[model samples]
Structures are given as structure tokens and as C-alpha cells.
Target: MVSLIRAIRDHTDEISCCAFSQSALVTGSADKTLRVYSTADFKEFPFSPLTGHGYGVHRCCFSSCGSYLLSCSTDGSIIVWSSETGELLSAVEHPGRSPLRVCALAPDSCLLLAGACDGTVALWDFPSKTLRRCAAASEASIVACSFSPCSQVFVTGCTHGDLKLWDDHISLLLAQKDAHDLGVTCCSFAPHFKIEDSCVELRLASCGQDSLLKIWIVSQREGTAWTMMLLHILTGQTAPVLSCAFSADGELVVSGSVDKSVTVYDANLGTLLHILKQHDRYVTAVALSPAFGLMATGSMDRSVNVWKIGDGYEETEAESQQAPCQGRKLPGHSRLLLADWTEEDVQSWLCEEGLDELVMIFKTNNIDGSEVNHMSKETVAELGIESVGLRGRLLRKIEALKAEQSGSEAPDEFLCPITRELMKDPVIAADGYSYERESIESWIRGKNKTSPMTNLPLRTTLLTPNRSLKMAITRWKSSQ
Candidate 1:
């Protein structure tokens, strides 16, 4: 259930690239300008439209810490900016006056990598603001580039559809492969995984004009060399795939294509889950924010769409209801303490304590506090408690009554009508029923203009924010 939060319309031309920081978003455009917008309020910066590039800006990115921004353009220059104030810090001229189409920042924020139309990759050290290495990665133009999470290695995709791996510190080619039949558009390294005591598994995802997405497994070989093996070839997009990104947890892969659609896939299962067709034109970029369960897509139609994603549970009502469970008993002491307590008694306690919102949540979810003892602290936090102090107090109380219980289940109302998982940002639609914002939006805009739960035609697609419900959900989470 992914939906659009807002569609910014400032850029005169198509938005080529977009990057999100801790509190702000930076976007580059073919209009030859870069704009900074506050994530808090989605307001453009006062001194925005950073205008130093002589040509269209192709790519923009934020450093790992979100303290700096790097933007590259067709003018053959990369400009670094202070993310806090949107001030120009420095500019590095690209070699051979080639359009720098792709760029990457190391995880440590110590190095910057840029790939240009001249088929060369340039590495620069941030501290000294000097070029450290520049080498030709391909005879064709470099289209996409990404650094491994560890920052020790990087991968570059060229117009000829060649994928090349390189050592970060020095310009050294480690491995090369012909990945696609047509030009490669984007490439990204998956989060690292520890497979064995001495073995680590790394994966690379690349999408290209061939309308296919490929995953490659990179692993350390016997001594000092690394080996790459094709892991999977995902084919569903009708048009060329332009951009791809791995979810923060690395369990999901999302790609945008020229076919005016976005596809979400199960990374581990290698299966298609959803094909979201919201954009009217080519979807050029897609980004996932695991921390907030958000997905954003930028398109050539001059719009940016933000979607709400669930925790990989897109089951139908029947499937979720049929999910298996393992039963376990509560601790003896805990059972004795709650022997005389009832749902009404818990509601009374909440009322007396001025926790009216939490009482509403309990009532809505059909929770009696009896199941609170079964939830772990982490699970409670996921309920969306906004007050840290209140969460801590609830955690201590739950710890006193908790034991190893396996048959815990969430309330049916907590699940979204579309995703069948607990709603992260629920909203009341025209049907007068609560649904996850993204889920409902996807339904009304992408699918049928009817309610999934009621299967009734919606008079209007308008939705109202369920603030009180959200507060109650937060309280419920704290209790869990």
C-alpha cells in the first residue's frame, strides 16, 4: 500500500534525481537547477534553487551523515553543498568536459565517486578536497555507480551494459561482467550478510534498458580474490528499468521503469509482490526509507510520489486469518495477578490515569492488557509510541508480567484492509473506515475506486488523518 504524500511542482523540467537526508530533500532537474526542501514541512528553502551548474543537473546525493550534499551536472562539474545552510562548499571540475551522470558517496563520507560520459571514474578525498584517482572504467559512457556498504569496494555500470567492480582506496579493477544486452541504467550494492564463520555474502542489483533486473552474488574466494555469480534475473517490467533500490533491511527490492510503473519484489523469495502504476510517465527514480516504512518515486511527468510500505506482509484477509500459530501459556505468577482483572477494569485504570487515548486504542483493537505480557519490548516500540518516557514506564510494567508466550496475535483492526498488516499511517477514507494512507491511496488511484474492506464504490477518494487513532496506537505500542 504505497501512496503519494505530495507532488512538488517547482522544477520547470523533469526531475532527474532526488536524495533524502535526515531533515531535508534535495532534487536535481533538467532545468539546470537544484532545490532543497525541508522534510519536516515539505517547504522549499528560502535561498533554494542552488544555481551554479552551467547545464542540467543529472544527480544529487546526501552524505551518509546527511551533513553534506553533492550534485553533478552536464556542465562537467560536481558541487558540494552544506546541507544545513544550503551553502556552496566547493566545486570539482570533471575531466574532459564530460557530463557526470552518476555519483556515489562512501559510507564513511570520506570519499566521493563520480562516473562521467567520458567513460571514466573519478575518486576524490573529502578532507583534502583533492582528486585521488581517475581511471577509465569502460569505453562506453558510465551510467550508474554505487559503493558497497562497507565502503571498501564499488561497482559501475556503463552504457554498453558492462558491470565493473573496483577497489575503493585505489583505482583497481577487481571483476567485470557483461550484465545486460542494452545500456545499464542503475546499480546498487545490497547490504552485507554474514553467511558463515569465515564467509560473507554480498549482492549487487542492476537494472538496464534491457527491461530486466539482475542480482549478482559477490563473495570472497580461496585466498585474496573475489568471485561473482549471477543469483537471479527478475523480469516483469514491460519497458526499460531505469532505477532500482534495496530496502534498508535488504529484504525487498523496488524498481522504477519507463513503462510508467514501479515494481516491488521479495528479495529473498525472488517473487513479484506489487506493480504500482501511479505515475503517468516514466518513473526515473525510487527510494525506500525502512526507518519510516516509506517509499518515494520520481517521474519524468514532473512529480514525486511518496508511498507507505508495510513490513512485507501483503496477505489477503483469508491468508492472514489462516496464518498458523504456536500456542504457549502465560507465567503462573502473571496469571494470578490478573485473575480478577477484565477489559473494563483495564479501561477504568487508563481513565483514572488520564490515559483516555490508550483506552480507545485497547477498545478498538480488542486488547485486554492480558496479551500485553506476551509482547517483547521491541515489538511494543513498533506500535508507534511517541513518548520515550511513557514507553520506558510501560516496558518495566510489562517485563514484570511477561513470560515466553508463542501464540500472540495482533488485533484484526490493527491490520490494514489492503496490506493485512498493522497500519503505520492510518487514515479515514470516504467510506468512514480507517485504512493505511498508502494502501487506500493505491487502491483508489492505482486499482479500483472502491473500498477493499467494504467493496463499495467510494463517493470520493478524499481521506482525513486519524490523529486520535494514531495517538491511541502509540499508547497501545507503549503498553505492549
Candidate 2:
């Protein structure tokens, strides 16, 4: 019915990247410090911090075993750290000006691949402390990349609208395709979690500034042969999708966007199950916790948010766990791809005390005909003093506040375009663009208004309606 995990408060400045380990989460930010928070309590530790990057971190990942962490910065340096103590173990510099955006670790953990700003993929070997191989894929900046769980095969996408698969040697190209016309910001591999009708298959999903999510299938044939097919396409996100990821079971997918929301999709059918609005700004990153039930995300708003995903929303052990891997909870949630919600309505209710932190809980039945909930012990514990209280009393109060104020929504009071803060007045943008505060108020409560002061629902109003803005408004009005 509601999300148990909420943002208590932000401790960092513009969190750029985040990684989840069993013990804690390590966040790298524009502040140039890596902050680790205990997953057990969502509590801040003594703060074992790492410093050195002159710019914000771009990407970060932990070894499959969770022993070592890797972080790449806009400064062109990749730093390896000990996950346990937050100690910097090694730093390698890429020979380019742009940041390293994507990374992958081989199954053996001995080899690592870093995708850089110059549209090149560089390989590194651990303990050897040497660069192994480097290969160029595109002329544009590389924004997204990932490795197939099965083989040495990996894929990378660039800002110039290209996607290519590569061999383990990082040399020969396995396949290449222009997946999108706009800059591809995120790409991910679908897990082979279900064996219901296996015929040597894999899936890849990519999203970009084009506002589309396309699914591709990788099929195998005789003698290392492969075929990629476009299976399904999802179009609804208002802005560019920032991240896309698969659920543990490969049955579901999730994505985040510049539009400030996260959407969950059924990986196989491409059904949009949930659209969550929890962040005040663009959602920069999203990751499924190892437990398969919990999900975590980071945003430019400088906060880390966690969500519990399961029940009617996910496949349970009874429905999924059978025979060979029955007891083994598939390494992830079933058929789910983690890709990365609604606003408070203010017209009907007097005030919404904590409407911004609300989350929806989906309880799905499994193959075994049993129900499961993804809310973890840590997630329930993170519930605020008012939420996880006696007999859900505090929850009742919070719900009461949301319900009373939700139906009476107002837009202008909902958010300030400039600071991404709550708007306070009948404010006019500096460029002379002004909106009727009542239009915002009505839209927030799910009311449709014909003459909204703000023409673009997905974008902030430009202070000046220049030629470009005029063209955008024209196109928007035409579409409407």
C-alpha cells in the first residue's frame, strides 16, 4: 500500500553515482567524497571518505564478490577502493578529456573494462596494475555500457546514437546497430532467468534523449553465431531516460529519467506496471539490491532513495523457484528489469505533511500460488519514527494528511522551476514567462486544464520564449 523506505535527509552535494553492497552503499558525488551508509540502519558511519577527483564522479561498481569497488570521475581517472574500509587501492587515468561513463567486470574478476569520454573502451587487469587493451567504438562520447552475464560479450552506446557489441578481447566487433537517433544515455542486458522456453537467448534494452525504450533480443545459432532483433518498444517518458536496469529474475525492468520519475516494466510483455515520483529532480542512477526485493536510486537532488519491490509486483519463490534452482532465489527478481510516480494533490485537502515521500507497494502472486513482499528488514527499519509506529498509527496520520490534501492539488505551489523547490507566489520567470498559479494547483490534483500557463509539462518554462522555445511550444501545441 505504501513505500516503507524514505529520504530522511541528504548528507551530500549533488550525488552523481551510487553502488550497493550487502553491508552498505557507497555514494560518489560532485562534492568529491565517497560516503558509505550502513544498509542495516540507513545510518551514517564515521564516514570513511575518498578524495582526489577535481570533478564529479560519473560511474561506480563493486566486484561481483563485493570485495572491491570501482569509481570513474569526470577528471578522467578510475579509482579502485577496498569496499570494507573505503581505502583507495589504485587509480588509473584515461588519456581523454571527457569522463569515464560506464564499466564492466569479467566473470573471473581478474579483468575490468572502462568506457571513456573519447568513445573508447579500455581493459585493465587487476594486480598487474597495467592497461590491457583499448578499442574505439564511436566518435561521440560513450554514455552507457554493459557486459552479458553469460560470455565475454559486452555492449556499449555513445552520445552519437550508436550501440555495438564487442568480444572479450575488446578487439573484434561482434555486432553494431544505430539503436536510437538521439544520444543513448542508458543500456542494459536482460537476464536469462527464466528457462520456460530457452533457445540460447538474451535481451538488451536502451533508452535515450529520444524518449523511447527499445528492447533487443540476442539469439545464438550454429558456431558462435548471433542475431539481434528488436522485440518491443515503450514510449511514455516525457524526457530522456537516465538509467535502465533488469530485475534479478529478468522478468521486470526499471528506468529513471530527467523527468524526475522512475518506471517499472514487465520485462517480457513490456507492461508499464508502476510510475513512481519520489525525487524532486532528475533521477541520476538506479540499482537493484542483491536481495532482489529492494531497489535504490540516486538523484541530482542530492539524495539516495530506496524502494521495496515484490508481491503482486514481483514473482515469488513458489511461482519461480523450482527443481534445480528451487531453493536458490534466482540471483535477481523474476523477469524484472530495474530501469530506473504521482505528485501530491492539494485542492481537496488542507495540507500534505509528507506526500513527497510516498511510495506504492505491489503484491504479486508467484508460480507456487503464494504471495511475497520485497520490503526488507533494513527498509522496514528505515521507516520513520511516525511510520513504523504502533499499529500503523503514524501511518494513519500520514495517510490522512496525503488524502485530505491530495484531491485539492495546485501546481504553482507544487514546485519552483528555478530551484526545484516549492513555489511560493504568483511568480514570473525572469525572461517574462509567467504561469497562472491556479493551473499548477489544479493539475497537481489530477485535474485536466485546457489553458495551462505552462505549455510544456515535461520541461521547466523558459524565462524567454526565444525562437527555439517558440518552435518547441509550437510543436507541443501541435501535438496537443
| Count of residue pairs whose backbone atoms collide, per candidate | 0, 54
User: Candidate 1: deviation at residue 112, Å?
Assistant: 0.8
The lDDT, on a scale of 0 to 1, for candidate 1 is: 0.73
Q: Quote the lDDT for 396 in model 1.
A: 65
Q: What is the lDDT of residue 31 in candidate 2?
A: 61
lDDT of 2 by residue, 213-318 (tens): 8888876654556667888788757898888888767877888889978888888999888887767679878877665366777777777776667642244332
List all candidate RMSDs to the true structure. Answer: 18.7, 14.6
How much is the lDDT of residue 187 in candidate 1? 90
Task: Give one digit per residue, the lDDT tens place, for model 1 in 242-333.
Answer: 99989878988999999988999888777998888756579998877535556767777666665557744233332222222101111122
Error of 1 at 154 (Å): 0.4
